[model samples]
Target: MDARYARNIPALTEEEWGVLRQKRVLVVGCGGLGGHLIDQLTRIGIGAIRAVDGDVFEPSNLNRQLLSKVSLLGISKAKTAAEHIHLVNPDIEAQCVEAFMTKDNVQALLADCDAVLDGLDNPESRKLLAAACASSNIPYIYGAISGWVAQAAISMPGDHLMELLYPEETVLGDKSVLSFTPALCAALQTSLCVKLLVGRPVNTGTIYYFDLLNQEFEIIPFNNR
Candidate 1:
């Protein structure tokens, strides 16, 4: 365990640790954002985690994906993420799924999760996850990054939320993502997940956008969501 995590454990009371331990989290896309999110979540004592990613780590991914390194090349993202989580805290339950997420498999993958983290790289998969969460009426924490910009939003079912807010085409823009952006976005997503689960104010119903180059951070108001 990291020294920082040991230092932070006292902040979590026995009841609080129990609450976090019992909660299950499903993390989709174990790439750049997913890697960081998994690390943070596990360090915070999240009990069970499901890591899903079909892609294999390549040399190109080493730049941003923490699980991708020279030695891990050719390994599946899910495998690397699962292994990393165990290294952080063997007490937590971790599962690695190296399959593409379709509408067919989405529900089962999401079945027992207390919450879903959308670390997916593409908008189509993101929308699919949102739809599943909507049908199940579970909270979905979403984060995406492109270039120096990142955006995050939380959608709860019955709001007709995600589709109403971010249209399919706009949300799923066919653009490449830069590495550093996902790292920052994933950190925020992890923090929001912990806060939401621990009865803390997560500032839900808002999309936060930050530009690393300009050092500007702004929140988009979506009170209706």
Candidate 2:
């Protein structure tokens, strides 16, 4: 076992840890949740990551984005994700797609990915990503964070999780987020993804909701459409 992943023992069996080193995942968006997702995925020894995001970092992101810094204010988030992942684990292949997730490019971005991580902040993009994942027959590990709340769910193929979660497409995104919110949500998402890729039992269509300010957590089970 590698020294860096030595702590993964007990929580992960040797076989499971080895499985992680062969799977590739696609992460959409590279800001708050996306940044932490890439960081954790790399450290835990994911074999490869396809990071997609066309946006550049700004001052507003300094508060929560792990890859954002004063000197990197105008840098591309997707490219930065690749750099950070390489720095964390040089063996991990971090592929950078410097483009937003759109109907035109979503399919190509998801190719050869074992799973898709939802690091997107908006509802419309999330819906598009879910649809793409469903079409590709890939598992979608969804995570979202707001001011004091976070939600994580796994959407298997043909599941209506996206439609049920985002019934209203016109819903505007909420920008209010605490520095710790994405970190917590990203951890939850990363764990779920690990379980998924390593053939562990994951409750598809079940949502894990957390309210940090109220110190409450709930497991909400829902039927898949």
Candidate 3:
């Protein structure tokens, strides 16, 4: 074990750390949640990461996107995330795909990954990404934030959690997402991903909801309808 990860200690056994270091994860958005997810995954020693996002950093992103800054305004989010990952852990192989994810490209993008992380803001993209993950039989770590509320879930192969959570034609207009919202959701999503990487038994069908305003946490199980 490298002295860098020595502090991980008994919490992450040598075998578990080795597993994590060999896993490949794909993060499908490079904004708020995507930035934090990539940062945490790199530091935790994920062997390979592919970050995909066609959007560029804007002034509005500074409020919640960790990888966005005044200096990086108008820069590609995927490229920025890849650069940050290298700075955090050069040993990890980081790839940046600067393209909007569509049905034609999603399968190819997710083909080699063991798992996918959802950092998308809109329901349409989320649904499409989830479908891709489902078809590929890759685990998907879903996280979303609206204002002070954040929710996370793990959708294994064949799970319809995404469909249940994001019903079709129910478009939610851009809602205010505070800085802390993505931070909190991303942390939870990272923990779930790590657990999956280490072969831990995660609550796959349950959605963890956090209402920061009310300081309440709830776990709700979703039935496959």
Candidate 4:
């Protein structure tokens, strides 16, 4: 047993740990949710990670972004993710792409990944990612945050959850998340990723919603055309 993952035992069977060490996942965005997602994914021992982000850290990101800090304000999120991943878990294969996922590069960026964890805030970008995952038969773990609220969902290929959830006119803005929102949401998203990778039964095509201040948790079910 690798002493590094000894703490994961009892919770994760030896077989499951071995399984996780052989799989790869792509984490899109490296800001609030992406920061936590990358941290959790690396600590959990996912064999390989491909982190994609184009934005550099700024003063506005300090409040909620885990990899953000005073001395690293001008550093790009991709560079920070690479640095953090190597420092946290050097054995795991890590690749950081210093660009946003766009229509032209989305497919290539997503290639060879077993699963994808969403940390992007824009609906259009999420739509692009969800579409690529659907086409490639990769499991997509959807995560988002707004103020005290966040939502997670699993969109298996052919589910078309993104299309059904976001209309063509969906505009991206007003994403007001607290300091803890991304951490909480990323935990849920990580759990879903583990469940899927470990062959556990998971609810697909459903949004797991959370309202922290109001203490409300709801399951919003939807269907594809």
Candidate 5:
């Protein structure tokens, strides 16, 4: 166990520790957002972690993905993230899946998780994850970025935040994306998941945007319900 996390989490009461013990969080896509989310959650003392990412490390990932390193290239993202978490906090039960999540693996991957964190790169994958979470009645913290802009939504089961937030197919298409955007979105998604685990509600059921070029952060609530 790292001294920092042990000191930061403090000594929990039996009940408090019990709450953390039962939490199983599944983080999909160990890219930029997933890397940072796993890093933070493991440090915060989450009981168990299931990290999934089909992608291997590449040179392009160095800028934002936390787990990417020159020496780590060609390694599995999930494995790298899991190893890092263990080094940071041995108490957390971290598992890594080297394959991408699909219809076949969605249920199995998400089966025991109390919450699902989406760090997916494209809408197709995001759609699949969202559908799985919705059908399972699990909450999905979704985030995406395109260039200088980022968008995030906290989709509870049955809410379908993406559909509500972006009804236009053109807007939801692949053309809208930026490098820095996903990093920002992932940060928000991770924050929301942590809040949920800590027994808090994030009232902003909307898409949050961060314009790095303009240096503006805006929360746009979708009252479509």
Candidate 6:
């Protein structure tokens, strides 16, 4: 193991690190959650990462998006994320796809990935990605944030966990997201992703909720509807 990963010893065995070095993950959103997810994954030694996003950094993104900077204003989110990943860990292969994930392109984008991480803000887009991952038989790690609240879950193949968690009528639009919300949620998502990559037992089909306002965390079982 490299000295860079010295601190991760015991928590992550040598065998686990080897597994992470061969895993490929796709992060479908490069804003708040996406930035943090990519950052952690790169540091953890994920062999390959595909970052997908069509949006550009804006002034509003400065408050929460870790990859956003005044100098990077108007820069592509996916490109910025890939750049940051290379800066952090040049050994990891980072692929940037500057396109919005849609039903037509989801499968192709997620085709070769071992797992998909959902950092998308739109519930509809998340649903589409979840369906695509289910069809591809890949695990989808879902995370969302609004104000001081955030939720995360692992939607395994055929689980349809997002459909039950995010109903069809849910309006997917801008919400008051705090800076700490995505940071916390993204960290949790990365932890879950690492567990999956390391072949650790993860509690799939369970929604983990965090309420920062009250500093409370809860896990709710999710059964297919």
Overall local distance difference test of candidate 1: 0.83
- In model 2, where do residues sit more than 4 Å from their true spots? 169-174
User: Between candidates 1 and 2, which one is better according to lDDT?
Assistant: 2
* TM-score of candidate 4 against the unseen true structure: 0.97
Please give the distance, in angstroms, between residue 102's alpha carbon in candidate 6 and its true position after superposition: 1.5
In model 5, the runs with Cα more than 4 Å from the true position are 1-3, 6-18, 166-168, 171-183
Number of backbone clashes in candidate 6: 0
TM-score for candidate 2: 0.96
* Candidate 4 runs further than 4 Å off: none
Is 2 or 5 the stronger prediction by TM-score?
A: 2
Report every candidate's CA lDDT.
Answer: 0.83, 0.92, 0.91, 0.92, 0.80, 0.91
lDDT of 5 by residue, 15-101 (tens): 454576679999999987888889878876888999999889998888778888999999999999999999988889999999999
lDDT of each residue in 1-225, candidate 6, tens digit only: 788888777899988998889989999999999999999898988999999999999999999999999999999999999999999999999999999998778889986799999889887888899988988899999999999998998989888788787787877564988899999999989999999889999999998999999999999899954
User: TM-score for every candidate vs. truth?
Assistant: 0.90, 0.96, 0.97, 0.97, 0.86, 0.97
Shift of residue 61 alpha carbon in model 6, Å: 0.5
Q: Give stretches of model 1 more than 4 Å off.
A: 1-5, 9-14, 171-176, 223-225
Deviation of model 1 at 158, angstroms: 2.5
| RMSD values, in order shown | 2.5, 1.4, 1.1, 1.2, 3.1, 1.3
lDDT of 2: 0.92
What lDDT score goes with residue 164 in model 4?
Answer: 83
